[model samples]
Target: MTSPTDPAARQLLAQGRLEVEGRLVDASNVTLYCALELDGLSGHAVYKPVSGERPLWDFPHGTLAGREVATYLLSEASGLGSVPPTALREGPLGVGMVQLWVDTTDDELVDVRPPAEVPDGWRVVLHAHDRLGEPAVLTHADHPGVRDLAILDIIANNTDRKGGHVLAGTDGRVYGVDHGICLHSEPKLRTVLWGWIGEPLPSDAVEKLRALPEKIYGSLGEELSAHLNGVEIGAVVERAEKLLSTGVFPEPGDDWRAIPWPLF
Candidate 1:
């Protein structure tokens, strides 16, 4: 299918008819695979309704949709362009978050093989045993897109950065999704992107972090304040400032679990 231009996709996401094509059974939350159409523009999208969110003790109830939109805003603010165009809108299932669905048919897994068989340039995060009892290593590619996404996750304070959430777009770009549990006041970062932890921040990534304050205080902040609490918004700014000062990828703290469960 032909993907719409960025502006067209954003317009459709902002104002379109979300026709539910089917339900994605793999997702933990209620996720609808949908087709968005507006003004002769048509494209596929994922819709997550606020009412369908399972309550989480750590996050406020019925705020996942907002968080999803907030991630898109953060992606735009950082100029990373890793997140698909997303918006909060009223759908057939009531208000929900709508995001452009990425085509991943040409995408490949990050790294799920033993060290001996792994390709060069792949950074292994940890070693594990496969179901067959053979050794396996979870790895990510040493590429700029992946690094940009890692930085984006840090700024968002993402708590659930599972491997599956990182998608390789057909356009050769990496896209990160399912950010409902992000931007919390407390530190809750958990992911598989630790390959670059403690490494000096790339100059471009550092510049993006430095530019974030202006974005946060501008329209992005106003938009997020509607869906997030004062504390959450404050935490976003604080994370940006801290990352800018550190000038490096952070190591996972001993205080919290550093990796997500069901890693894939």
Candidate 2:
């Protein structure tokens, strides 16, 4: 239910007092759950401090939190609106990524089920066997917001778009989270959103792509300069252009593994 675009929500996230409530133990980096409040506006948030980020062999050290914020910026600029409101700020641990926490529903947007059991209206991304050698299929709901996330992932060059990162919020919004490994200059798009392969880009998606250059050269480009280098920012524009030129959902390439390991 966190609406960061609202004036009050923006003010609360930027100036609210933060109190650590708990920690997400399964997170690779130190992820803290916090309660934030300012002028009676209160909500929960997640804080990931750069000091606690685990070093990755592929990505630059201590830059994950900034990438998270940058990804949110691109998502907003693209009119995807599938990413939660994320910001970079000082927390109890240190400077890090802070995002408004989404209250999710029980709806399972993505799932691995027997091929015959794929739900009606769902899109199947892959057909494979499970650990028990049972026929399984990776499927996701065919929702407009989910498609928005797919387009966002393409432009962001998201390296890890696992099933768990797709959240169906109680507010009837679909959100993509945990964008610490995105917006790279290189081609490392790993995602579970290939269900729309070769299909024409939705009208809304095309319009957003058309308008991206104007926003990119304006405030969006200036803000991203803090997190990404000139080359990386330019790469995003290139990806958008490619996607627009193709006018269709992109196909996975052979150079890298298309789907992330342990899809969920």
Candidate 3:
């Protein structure tokens, strides 16, 4: 029911307000920086909401129209990405706001922490790091979760699966986020899930993916289509079907594959 034409979306946008150092953040492009508190959650959070727009065109028609649908797809992935934040109806900020609070510290959640917290005035690109070095790399190749993520990214045509986007939790689980660059009509899939190059898809996972095209088209797909072209939507559905049939990565068709070989 959450569609691009939904009337309530406008109402919520007009009323929601958050301030930093007495200056209200911009929400005109459907992007906003706000704090949200959720019941039973660990702490308050600063959230950035994307509404299928330009800056997020790595996946055109994504940030603008099909965000809620993307959230649904992620939720269906078995322990793969962040779940959609609960849309707050009313809270300390005010009323009629659509924002998802980022309060989960679960390692399973992606590492979406805002650049070092400052005194209401801060601007810096967040860097990715691990115990080893600056550009963190995943070494192990046998992870089922990582393999699944690669497949998901391929199907969605995700282009920006930055090292920072993959989060490893204390619970020994991994999660992916920042899918704003997904589901493109063109091939833009770029990722680092080649750890399991030849492994077959687990039967159960394939079954779920096989069933996704119908479910997405039924309700989620309808909601997504309002924000994107039918061709793009069909591409996503087709990619899913291909995965269900092959049970292995299809030939890499995008220019994103094949990084330059080692120079040394």
Candidate 4:
């Protein structure tokens, strides 16, 4: 079967040593933070190998995709669906590896520690936030940032946008993560932003989508296109145009709507 732990796993193992350092995440898949050796290079990062054994606890549905899911979400956020990261060459144990990377330059929202404890052992992850902060009030109807997220979710076919998934960076920008169960052939879209349903879409939001096709294709299109089919991309464009034409909050069909759960 084509699993996330397929060729990549073999490649990773061949390039590095696998020392299971125990569980890092006890959610759906029981992610084990492991030490790996990439040739002579080595570092510590979360390793989620696939197994048939199911967890006893009830994790939210579609939580088991692990790093594959994380990678997809990162692609959506960067506007590039498959941007590559600096490969970790095995050097030493307990350092030089970070599996799920937000921006290496920005303060990430997925770090799992108390604030005072600076993220260490991994260089890129040093800036990550252990916990996601509060959501800003949706102050205006013409917020381009919010609209960008809406378009992003639509393209990715996201089913969940838990408040926790909406990361408020220490910097004044917003970031989103966690996209394991997205971009499927199915229409499993679900989100908690129903209040905007049927509301008038802001004119600015429409303009943004109009320009996005030509604008984003130069940089973001290449990566995303690698993962999504042409029909999917066309669908994204079609929905974006429809949203633009309406110039109002849309009462989208079940396939296009969002899930009703908040991560907080």
Best by TM-score: 2
> Model 2 over residues 1-264: C-alpha lDDT tens digits?
346445676667778888999999988889999998988789889999999988788887339999999999999878875787888988899898889998888999999999888889999999999899999999999999899999999999998999999999887989999999998888999999999999999898899999998888889999999998888889999999999999999999899998998787
Residue range with the least summed lDDT across 10 consecutive positions in model 2: 1-10
Off by over 4 Å in 2: 1-5
- Model 2 Cα displacement at 27 (Å)? 0.9
lDDT of each: 0.85, 0.89, 0.48, 0.45
Candidate 3 lDDT tens digits, 2-111: 22223443333333443322212342233444532223222222233342134642444434324444543444532333333324233333322243323223332222
Candidate closer to the true structure by lDDT (higher is better), 2 or 3: 2
Query: For residues 1-264, could you state the per-residue lDDT of candidate 4 as single tens digits?
Result: 111223454355436566777774534544556665555544554544435225424223232333244335334444532222213223233222224322223444333344344344211111223235622222112234444555566555566755445544333445455444455435655643333556676555555567756643555455445445555555555655666677665554744534443333
Error of 3 at 213 (Å): 1.8
Rank the models by lDDT, top first: 2, 1, 3, 4
Sort the predicted structures by TM-score, highest score first: 2, 1, 3, 4
lDDT of 4 at 224: 47
Most accurate candidate by lDDT:
2
**lDDT digits (tens) for residues 1-264 of candidate 1:** 336336678888888888999999988889999988887888899999988888899896338999999888888877764898889999989999999999875555475888798778888888999999999999987877788888888888888988888888877788889999988889999989899878898888778778788877888889888888877888888998998888888999899999898787
